[model samples]
Target chain A: MQRTIVFDVLNNDNGQVKAILGAKRFIEENPEYKLILVGQEEVIKNTLGKYAEKVEIISSNEIAHKVISPRDALRNQSSMLSAFNVLKEGKADAILSSGDSGSYITLASLKVKRLPNVSRPAFMPVLPTTTDKKMLLLDAGANLEIKAEYLNEWAKIASEFHKIIFKSNKPVVGQLNIGTEDYKGTEIAREANKLLKEQADNYSFKGFVEPSSAINGDVDILVADGYAGNIFLKTLESSFLGFAKLLKQIYMRNLKTKISALMIKKDLKGFKAKFDYRNTGGAYIVGLDKVVVKAHGGSDEVAFYNALNQIKIALDNNVIEKLKEVFEQAKEGEDE
Target chain B: MQRTIVFDVLNNDNGQVKAILGAKRFIEENPEYKLILVGQEEVIKNTLGKYAEKVEIISSNEIAHKVISPRDALRNQSSMLSAFNVLKEGKADAILSSGDSGSYITLASLKVKRLPNVSRPAFMPVLPTTTDKKMLLLDAGANLEIKAEYLNEWAKIASEFHKIIFKSNKPVVGQLNIGTEDYKGTEIAREANKLLKEQADNYSFKGFVEPSSAINGDVDILVADGYAGNIFLKTLESSFLGFAKLLKQIYMRNLKTKISALMIKKDLKGFKAKFDYRNTGGAYIVGLDKVVVKAHGGSDEVAFYNALNQIKIALDNNVIEKLKEVFEQAKEGEDE
Candidate 1:
């Protein structure tokens, strides 16, 4: 059976050229899956060349810009919306975009159908930790004010994604909080912590964890209300970026420092690879019926290729199909 | 006039020995000021020696351990509580503690009276940026949920402190959000953003800022609701710590890397000094009538000395006194 992904190869911060190149690479490498490319008809067709015959192309020249309201985002007939429409019409198995997250999330929640027993969809991004493992952080921005039930539900979906995506038997789930103590955090956090502990069948619940634990890779899935989670994600990214910038300045200070940098160039590259966003692919909008991944806005050829491959893994393993069955059965059990 | 600070020398994560040494150093350096030390009397007295005669030592063997309830924190006869009682009784002009933040905040809110026109006290910490100038972040786990009015009030208080501490005539104030976009974040956040812009009277208000702007030191005072602010602070601190740890591992990998390390040792030391917590001192419990600072739990002698210095600067410049007058006038205006 052939799988398909609706690729919104436009509205990227660096322009559509890199996204087009990434799509071409993915198509050339993976013959089992195809992409319905949504972008400027001429550029994508001209770029894909031989691979053009292998996939479908939706003519969409309009790029999605940051809008003032949710209504504006929905009303705009952009490539991102076109991709979502394709996915909503069941024309593809998944959707990928490097567009602004605000509109992407708005479209995901509006267009994508929720899985059984799923209250709200969450933005779950695969993150690189200090260790060899990669972790998942959910509700990073999709729903700032979330209920306790929403967290527990997201945790289950995120853990399923983690177990299949990362090849873990049972992912360790943790609620991101100021402290690990039960007495800390808001009422919603405490309630979610209690619920996760009571229902730890899917994953090994690690209780409430601090941001340090998430960075150290102590848990597989770190859940929080969208506001705190987004703050954590952004700060973690900027701090590393800031630190690397300082390190570069230090190495480029003078001839002696530049030579010192040359001595450990290979090792430094390894360290850089560990924290690079490109290798990890993109953020997934979980709890939806189909795989909805949002690539980085500035994603290059390598990053987009990795993102498509990320979708391929989730599709090949039938993680979404498995989740549908699990959720449906749980709903049935509850009704009984 | 001689000034005094109720120093809770017990409850340090490292131990009371370092706190005593730090006190001795501060007292030696400043003949006009004194610390009403609250800790194991024998140990503090022996460590202080001649300096012990200069400062007041209150015998308190009970260390403030982590308690389950707010009632327990206040009811317990620990050194922290004892120190707070002494401060509340007007025996000292300030208070300093390197204890657990949870109980400390609980005590500060309950024991310490708010300044006139102040709704709530906020936890403000001076943070190091990539640049030379330090920035202040407030409500870092002090009040997780807040109104827009609280943010506006905090901005006024934080700016006053920033001006005196950073010696900036007009500090640049920015409210930290997930994004700089106006249409983003919670209602309170958006409202606060508008309020800050409208009332850019005291300081040069720079609307809403992202975590990146804070790290780059684009704003002098980065304000946010306690939940988001805390998440940002924790993530930033841990990421830098994590990066530093990775860098150390790379340099200690082999003899070649070790030699490479020595070549850049001077530059690396400069980078380390910039991010070190000891230099930045401690977090201020702002909006209180008296100057209250919370040092890092694992603070050593140098860190304690810096924290004392931080308090001294606040006291010497009469920042608290000025704020009292300003807030009192505002209250009177509001009454009119």
Candidate 2:
């Protein structure tokens, strides 16, 4: 299949550099794939250098920054919208961004085409876990609040992705809660458990999983609402930093400890490498018609390389095509 | 000062045996303190054994498990409430429990007492950073939904405790949010930032902290609502386990890695010790009239010993008295 990946550059940040580099690499490696970079004219040209022909400057004045609220994206004729417009017009196969996640999500959902039967699209980040692997946590920050039924849908969607990408025959899907029991969480958890139990064949429906076990690679798909998922992601990010900071403090204490640290730098590096989010590709806003992936705000060149690889994974797995089929199947089953 | 510590056990699993040992040690160390063990006749007798004279067993049919919900504690008249009654009658200076955290907090608040100028009590857990040094995080699992104003109060309360115990001249208090800036987070964060800015002296209110950087050991007091804090605590707990699991998996990958792991067992042990929650004592229910600490549900003998040490710290610091003084001072300032 031919691949045409576009970067909707709302600002001149590390994301833009990454998208361009990733696109260039993709074209060089895959021959059949085309890469397009869209942003301000002078900025895109300057960033692309000799590869300026492959990159397209759409010339967008609307800027989306961390300060810019999601509502602002709706009012402004932003680059974000322009990038999605290209996708809608079949100019690009997918859009990858490391910009404002909220604004981009809102723009993609409203302006870009949404897949049928997806009431709310989820920004799912496949986070690395301590169990020497990773799990796909859905709705990392898409919907603020979640319902049990919606969570059921999230479980199905995430499970399908796991089966398609990871090739798990019956990927285990667990609901994120405080405890691992049928009646562990608040009202939503209990109801979701009931719904998952009824459709046990399609999903593993592994009851409740505590936060500690959720990222242990014990489950393939972890389902949570946007609010909880966002908190989870931020907390995980903070905890890694906290642990790193603590280690740095201990190593810096006096001359004796500093010597001990030098002896273990290799071990510490191995540890740090395990939790580095940059190695993982951008998070996908699943349940959209076209592939939309959100990169980290502080993503560097290497991280963009990871994102490019992830886009291929999504493309090869037929993420969009599988989603449409599953949602339609769910609806048809419900109608019966 | 004369100290009378009460231990109530009904339906407790080996609690009487543990409490008896703990009581005997305390009596042997500090002759000024008295130990009152409240539980069943035969079980308490068996636990008391040779130290039966030092331990006083008051007959009570109340059992509090970590799994028991608040409603069960409320409905079971003899269980948690009866233990609280022991504290109310001036029989005990503090109540120590290896039981449920929720029950301990609720019973301690409604039955024993509620502190002045405090609407709801909160649990403050000290978490270790990577360097193995610990920082205090408040509302670990007490208040589910709280406003920015409540966060300000929580910060104040946490600051006072840290000041008294940790003896930091100017305790830095930070509101946990998604990012560090003048403007960020949900509406609650914005309001809390405004209040914290005004009372900079009383607290070293260090604007906002990103979730990733919040537990960096730089901030003396980290404050948030219970729900978010609980999730944060859980995530931290899980991430550590995840890292450990991943390391173990890497070690088991082949013979060469297993040999490297064998050489690093001592270093790994040191690293694991730093992440141990048992070293940080137990969580204290702040904004309460009396100091009540909740041990981890799966706490062993070592954790209980830490809880005892925490009780000592609270009493020595006079946290409850300091809270009264703070409330009065704030009230007077408001009135003026």
Candidate 3:
């Protein structure tokens, strides 16, 4: 059986032609997957050449209109909304976008709707750790003002998502905080801790985890409000990039150092690849009725291809169906 | 012009003997400065040997008693508290402690008291950036719950501190947020942004800065609530250590890489030093009536000595008196 994946090829830094070519390559690699390119038909055909014939085109004149900013994107619907409409109509198994995340999230929530019993949707991204395993950081930047219940829901959603994606039967969920102590953090954190403890039967609750522990692979999933989670993720990213930049400066210091750098260039490249966000595809907009993966806005061809691969994985593994079943069961238990 | 500095040689990982030696060396190098060692008399005398005669000892048997954790340190009065008492009584010009930060902060706030009209005290630490200039990150981990007013006060205090220390006429203050957009974050952030904007006359308001911009030195002072600030600081520290560990593993993979590593070992050490918190001494407990510096609990001899050096600078520069005058003038203006 083939699955249709909608690719939003607008507002990305790589330009529409490059994104369409990336999507065409993805379709060629995976015979079981098909693409619906949502952008200008003439531009897609001209850039993709022979490959454009394979993908279904959803033409939109608004694709080239400047969004001004993320705030502007959020206030008005862009061409990316056309992509989500296809997903909502059951024409696509999953949707991938490299546009404004805030706008995509808002449009997805309004158009596709939320899962049963879920008050808020979250952005769950897999982060590479020092160990062989990867950690899931949730609520990356969806809801700014989060209640205790939202964190509890995120933990549950992430745990199931982890099980489906990573094949872990029982994943440990850690709430992000300033300290690992039970009594640490704000009023919302303490309340969420209690709720998570009570629901330990559903998932393994690992009390509190600081930002360092989250990066060190202390737990399978780390959950937090969008504000703290965003800061934590951005800090880790910036620090990694900062160190890389410093190393480049050192490597280029003199002729002697440049020779030494060349001696270990292969090893350094491998190390840099481990911290690259492009390799991880993009974050999943969890708790949505349909599958939506947000690729980096500045994504290149390689990054866009990985994001398309992620959607293929999600569709193959029945992630959306499994998530819906879990929430439905929980609601049934509450009703009884 | 000489300053009397009290060193709290308790709760540090280097034990009393090693801490005493570090302090002894600091006093010997600076003939104009005097020392007051706060610890058990027997341990101080036994460790000091010949240096014992030159310094004063404020003995406390409770110095050897285990503090257990930061929470335990917060509840009881320890030897570090005895040192704070000395500073409160005007016996020492400044105080430096290498113990549990929460306990030190609690004792300092209780004994030394806060400056008039200051609701909460904060920890302000200098972090090295890619640029030649260093950045001041405040409220590193003091109050868990912060209001817009607290941020307003932090900007005012940090601006004054920056003007005195860095000799800048006006410092630019950046509030840490998820985005630089005007309508990006929570209500707290929105309110604080408005307050910071209104007070642009007193200091240069750089607007909201993401975690990456903060580390890259987009502004002179980065202000955030303790919860978010601690996470940001800890994430940077952990990420730097993680990358260093990864590089070491890569370098030690083969004989060829090992030789390359040895060739760049000196440059690597220098690069690592720029990100070291120990080199910056420790974070200062700002908004207090007196000078109090909190060194890392696991600080070694060199780190402890640098912390003491920080105290000496604080005292010699009349930081306390200047801060008091600033607050007093502000209060007078408010009364009118």
Candidate with better DockQ, 1 vs 3: 1
Top candidate by DockQ: 1
Q: Report the C-alpha lDDT of model 1 over B242-310, residue by residue, as the tens digit.
A: 999899999999988999999999988989999899888899999999999999999999999999999
**Which is the better candidate, 2 or 3, if ranked by TM-score?**
3
Which CAPRI category fits model 3? Answer: medium
Could you tell which candidate, 1 or 2, scores higher by DockQ? 1
TM-score of each: 0.98, 0.86, 0.95
DockQ of each: 0.84, 0.37, 0.68
Model 1, DockQ value?
Answer: 0.84
TM (chain A) per model: 0.98, 0.91, 0.93
> Quick one: ranking by TM-score, best first?
1, 3, 2
Compared with the true structure, all predictions reach lDDT values of: 0.90, 0.72, 0.82
- Cα displacement (Å) at residue B104, model 3: 1.6
User: Which digits, one per residue and each the tens of the lDDT, describe model 2 over residues A72-172?
Assistant: 67666667777777887888878877777767877777766677776778889988776656789988877766777777777777787777667778888
Cα deviation in Å at residue B71, candidate 3? 10
Scored against the true structure, residue A289 in model 1 reaches a CA lDDT of 96
Question: Using DockQ as the measure, what is the rank order of every candidate, best first?
Answer: 1, 3, 2
A188-229: candidate 3 lDDT, tens digit per residue:
889999999897655799899887777878899989988888
